[model samples]
Target: MNRKKSLQIFIQSPDLHQIRHESVTGDQTLADLKRSLFPESNHRSSFYFTLHGKPLPDDTPLSIPQIAPLSTLVLQSRLRGGGGDGGATGAESRDCYLKMYSEKKPDKVDPNEQRLSKWQNCALSNEPLREPCVIDKLGNIFNKEALVEALLGKKLPKEFGYIKGLKDMITIRLSSVPRAEDGAKFQCPISGLELNGKYRFFALRNCGHVLSAKALKEVRSSSCLVCHEDYGEEDKVVINGNEDEVAALRERMEMEKTRVREGKKNKKVKGESLEGSRLSGTKHVMAAVEKASAKVEVNGKVSNGGGAAKRFKAIDVAPAHATKEVYASIFTSSRKSDFKETYSCRSLPLGRN
Candidate 1:
């Protein structure tokens, strides 16, 4: 009976400047919980209650979906104009719906949803982020093993062809936030904001400083907010960016690596010179070339009457599975041919025609 109620939620103040965590069990009523949480204002009726822009009645019990654990409850005064959480009356104008009923806040983002996308899941495989993770030039994180598997299977999407190989990306070290029952796994080191989708975050390329994007705008410095080290615009990679940002990042990566590709192309040897050919590579093909040249040499000396003709030894080119005799039989002169060898008439004078 003494244990704390596990169904927890966050309560945002009127100014949106502070958030307080509150928990309730199934047995507790909403009025009792709210009254206990906000005791200072007894006459104000504590304004109205809201859960994600939708109005909630004072008596709404803790066991319903609206009161689910980890959901946020915002407390706003009538003056702020986001007051009505319950649906307006039939006579109420469209402006009432736009101001109170609309869930579309100008820059509203679900922290839980963003957390899953940015920290728990990967971009390449669309799977859970596991050990051996990697980050790209755009600060997008992925499971390294998944990327390797996709690369080997040739299953990578055509749009991601910018990843020429492992060289295009680097292994990134993530500073994991300690786990809590309702805590985010990653966050901005400087702002202390959770890396949930509610706020934009970026990682520094040189030093791996992951922080909120607001820090960059406010500081407006060319150095990291956390490390205070010098960095260029190219070094700051936005996390979980939109399509245009991703496309720009991919282009920048390819453009920067162009020099590496050109250098490799320039370093390759064009062709070996005649004098250089004999000095390099295997001798397996060399034996075949030598045998052919020996045939020409033998015929030339005999015509010139230089001396006894030199004998050319046939090189063994048979596969390991073949015997020398069987292999040689394939090319021996014993094979029958349709044409006969012709000799000069003067040279054959002593022989019968």
Candidate 2:
């Protein structure tokens, strides 16, 4: 039986700036080993591993004769513009001169370039070159796919519950450019790995700032990074929102409208009730006034001093025959001709003759 063996390898870049130690089995391929060490370098076509200044074929197994345990490997990108003898062509040498000249030219570089570079990174995670990007109103860009996942209840690094809806988000389109003859690509402001749709992205509804969904999960507050707008769970919306999400947003809006309408209706009802109470109070006041006026007319005259008291005493002492005679004398005509005319008219009225 062949025993499985593991070897620890020290991997470094050509500039020796980044070094990582990884343990690999004898059966593992060099490509797999490189992927484990530097995930971002996988897209390069001409990158290779070197042991003691010698290139190793990608298919060479770790158990090869030239490689041993604890071996040191350097990963390097191939130089472009080589001649038949592997020497630099005249045109290539001139190109190098031109590149050197451009680097030394201070006028070509902008002073605010560093600040601008920071803007290209994900504001939440500070990771550069996140794709499927969305910008908020304030021009901050974030990864949209990660944000959608977060909205769907996936765990995220930053808490971006502040975005209210997807209507406030817009997706950003990135253009790619070739970097070298090895087909290496360069994208401004983003130096991270290619967006493989594995990670999710999000944007702030108010500010349009974009970030990774993972980074948004780490947010501790509801404030936007760029615009500083306060947001809630409803404020963090999905970018390029699907129909169901849009419908849900519309439904939420409708619910809010209904609540507002109900509030107004309740206010109107309360106002009308108050008005009714006021009108009822006014009616009661008017009725009391009328009652007081009638009482004054009937009883106030009697209650006043001696004249009214004297009159009342006379009426009480007077006989009923005298009272009737006084009323008849005042109402009946005194003239004889007038009495005769009234009697004749009454006598003829009974038979329509």
Candidate 3:
């Protein structure tokens, strides 16, 4: 034990999530730390120390930059996996020794601790959160690739039906916690508070910058504090919100989609109406011109001093706004032909009679 430099150790063997504190010198080795956690055990070499989910070399000195003071270090056993064991213990000894030990089965990993370990994993696939991550209105994060695969495979759950397409969600850029020592995973850039569900956090849709709600309210600015990007009230989304908070967000999402659909329908109706009016106007102008050009005879008198009075037939064009079924019938063989298909030499073809 040394008083000069101190570090925090989190061993997860007997009791999970239980942090054990032990002071060590800069020149001390990892083996020494393992012995402190299990002093009575002669199987000290059977365990190892891990930092940031990576196992350190047995001879690694604690003076390195990565081993920051008060930073957490996890203790893991060297044994890997097990299966095919009997009910109580594997007395055959042909099976792995881990199964043969009745009293010393591998400690069960706490469910909450498992979730904390997978903090950066995708909510849908439970895989590592990769680039192109998407956040729904309820603030649940998911991998875009995993979502696409699920959609294509037709295996998406009914509860996730709210995510109709990419339009329902927004992409967010998360900022990792800078301090490696703390148990927090993500952090608020402005307040520098841990974003481990303890405090309220919001990610701006305009800039994807995540900041604590306290910071945004204190400054009272319309732009993101981190990137200074301008944003509207609709762009702000709560991260990992409570039940009531998420319900409000879901209602807002539905309203926005409804407004957009209404706008599109209105545009289509306006366009169709304009085209219909133009076609009808053209037909009326044609009828007026036919009357103006035609001459008529009255009481054996020449009209408009013309050499001969004349009559003109009205144009026989079909209406432009016919339905598909009527339009198709216009080209059938039963319809009257305006001009006959005269044969050149009174024969249909060489093979015809």
Among these predicted structures, which one has the highest lDDT?
A: 3
> Quick one: how many clashes does candidate 1 have?
2
Best by TM-score: 3
Which stretches of candidate 1 lie above 4 Å from their native place?
1-115, 219-229, 264-353
lDDT of 3 by residue, 1-353 (tens): 13345443335442355555555777778877777667899988877766655668888987787876545666756644455473433222422342343226543444454445344566776555667878877787788888888878877778788777777667877777765564766778778886566678888987777789999998899888888889998989997678898998989988988999999999999999999999999999987766655555434454552433363212222356665456556654435544435565443444555
Residue-by-residue lDDT tens digits, candidate 1, 1-353 = 22233455667654765566665676676676777876776744646666656666777777774565556776655433444777554423533554564455533335555456456667765455666777777667878997887788898878567665786565655556767345566666666777657777777777766768887787798887767789897787877788898888878877878977877666654333533665654474676565554443332342222323344433234576777666666775534444445674332333445
TM-scores vs. true structure, each candidate: 0.40, 0.29, 0.52
Please give the CA lDDT of all the candidate structures.
0.64, 0.54, 0.68
Give every collision pair in model 1.
55-85, 55-86
lDDT of 2 by residue, 86-150 (tens): 66566445445544643585212222332333344454433454677765433345667645655
Superposing all C-alpha atoms, what RMSD in Å does each candidate have to the true structure? 14.4, 23.1, 16.1
Model 2 residue 91 lDDT? 49
| Candidate 1 lowest-lDDT run of ten | 299-308
